[model samples]
Target: MNADRARGAGAVRSPSTATFLSFLWPGLGQWYLGRNRLALVYGLPVVAVALAALWQLNGGLADLAIQLFAPSFSLTVLVLIVLLGVWRLISMADAFTAAPLRTKSSRRPTTLFAVLALLAVIGHAAAGFYAWSFYQAGSKMFVAGLGGDFNSVAPGASGSGTSGDLVAKPGATPATADSRINILLTGVDSSVGRNHALNDTIIVASVDPKSRHVVMLSFPRDIAGFPLWNGGTFSGKINSLMTYAGLHKDQFPDGPLPSLIKELGYLLGVPIHYYAAVDLDGFRTLIDKVGGIDINNPRAIDDPDYGGWTDGRPLGFSLSAGVHHLDGQSALAYARSRKGNGDNDFTRARRQQQLLVALARKLTDPSMLTRLPDLLAAASQTVRTNFPADRLSEMLSLSRQVKDDAIQKYVLGPPYALRSTDATTYSLKLDLAKLSALSIKLFGADSRYAANAPASPSKSP
Candidate 1:
């Protein structure tokens, strides 16, 4: 009787204990049950997957997070997460089955296994949810055809008649790695009282991947007297171009946004590859989601005549000169207020750049991880971009490597753009020659004026 009891005690293995072990790691429970081959079968694939994921994440989590914006990658991750959940549940169940069916109580082991399976499902479901969110956001953000025909004749291709007579150039390819990338960034002011959306803020972000350099060129909404893409000249406010073109599609077949992009690209002397447009009202939501941003005021601002529009602050904006933390509404006012003393579109443009940098800093803060979901949701509603989703990870990584000093900011004000007026209107006029020189300096041979550039002085023998 004593020998038989000893054998029984030695053979007994709690099914609950084996299940819990597998819950910690696939195959661990099988190993506990002495099923060595089964343990290898369950664990090796997981180990291999982990290593592969780490290899893909060599650029780190930030790069991975950005890559997740690509719909294909996000969907792949969602599938892997689902498969992982299934594998975990299967491993746990296999462990439970292989273990000796003996325990202090059968009810407790069954309950524990059920709870572990439930947890695995919940965890993976949450991961899948976030992945789905990223997929949806990316789908909306990286839309194609938003910028119109990229191969279209840029306003004044020598033989091209006039801006109104432009034609698409067939078989043109997208920007290559050797080329500079120019993205048009615009802020649309579409308030409740406004009849039409006005792209009041226009900035072109030019990036050279080889040099890892970036330049932001801001165009005042009131810029006028600029040469049109065709050989003709425009005499109205630049901001009105998009709306006018949209209304007169018979003349500008590319539609409103694309027409505006092409003209801007022509003026900048570079091919604008992408565009990002943000609604001012939704912009506020984005700012709030990432928390408020901080900016140093160069001078005190007191714009008593400033109308807050739909922002609900009708008393006008006032701020003392110094470093100030601004919430969404105040930041909007800071970027929009033109009635302040010594304030105009030029200063407003600078402030807008300042706010942009600040917002970027805030979004990259480690603490913002907890707010990522909300931030992404806000961004989906507030912003639309046609930038390639696949290249986002590279851009995100490069953006982190770039320091504040390396970024060049220009407002196209003063020397670059002169204020002009007639009996009926006041506008800012572009200094074409100076702009061409600046473009050559920024883009070298990539500049449209490169062919016309003066030859270098000959070297003495």
Candidate 2:
């Protein structure tokens, strides 16, 4: 039964059948053609690679996809992919060159090839379509935030028109001709059921382009009476500067952001080169895209007012004083919570600055290469920045040079800013003398020396 049946089976198998089977699995066609030894030789390597890939993506399909594109496994994965392609080609060739079937066949080999070709075309077409769609959507979102769409009349047209062009105005001058660049990073809390959104987190970062040294100064949102671009000063909370200017667009013809940047420059006594605003919701997405952020919570944060998606029920959030890996929502709460721990706005401001540092640490990680797409998508939706896209290389260079210990953080509280009671609200009054001294120490030095200075970093207050 063994040798007789084997001979008869080999006689009946066709080359087309062999090719189709090999197309499905590297050695499957050989096995189908009654060549057991050759099938193992061809399929084992491919099967091993597939198994290794599955192992690497043990977390899930989503996790596997992220790992595939990540920087760590990029080279190895690429090599494996090339090997697999070659193996598949060999498999198909072996199948098609095999002996033709002797017995009557149920389906023609050409019919099978046609079906495979159609499937391959459909798969590639679908992939290409999605890729193009993703690219277009991302481009539109980036342009929308990078610069206003400008719904006014196009150059010569009399009627109102919409332009897709991204016209980013030149940001303010670098503090010292590229020696240092300063940017205003504002976090806005604009959620559902709220008519007005407040710039709750305001941080001014001065980065040394050459050394990649960075100094971040966090200003409390409640600091009032800050001067605006126009003659009038921001009478209420300093955080309201942008919102007020936005409301009074007549006084601020260039738009609220420009006016706010100019005023902030005046207040800080340092030229702010650019501004990047992220919606509070965007912060969550950004954090998640980077696989979350790691932060050392110096003090426990417990906020009774921590609003969440839970219907009408407050998220009585709390974080212990220790190193914690926080997801987007938890990180947001950590950065925004101001109650239940006897912490004031100043504490929250410090936490916000710390969160930024943590985010920077996460982004500079070599593993983030695979996460770039998700991050870019999140940024397009949640962030609006005047920072030029063409200058991204320079930014990346600076970011690479930024050392964790070299980041100097200053929160305007206590000696730098005094708490004052205003009606029912508590506001901060800037101590001009102290703020000037801090600014000079952080930003007034020469770029080269400022970057390499051996001064010990100050701990966050």
Tens-digit lDDT track of model 2 for 48-145 = 88788678656444344333322224445545555665677677777766646455554446666656545544644544443443343233332322
**Candidate 1 per-residue lDDT over residues 1-461, each given as its tens digit:** 44324433466666887899889889988777767678899999889889989987897776777888898999998889889889999999998877775544454477788899999889889988888888877766666555443222111111221223222221122457646677888888777787767887899887777777789999999899788785587777898887777677676776677778778878877777777778888777788787888899999999998777455657878999999988888888888998888999999999988888788778766677778789778877777776778988767767787788878999998888888855167788889888877778777777776668778522211
**C-alpha lDDT score of every prediction, in listed order:** 0.76, 0.64
| Lowest lDDT block of 10, candidate 2 | 151-160
> How many pairs of residues collide in each model?
2, 1
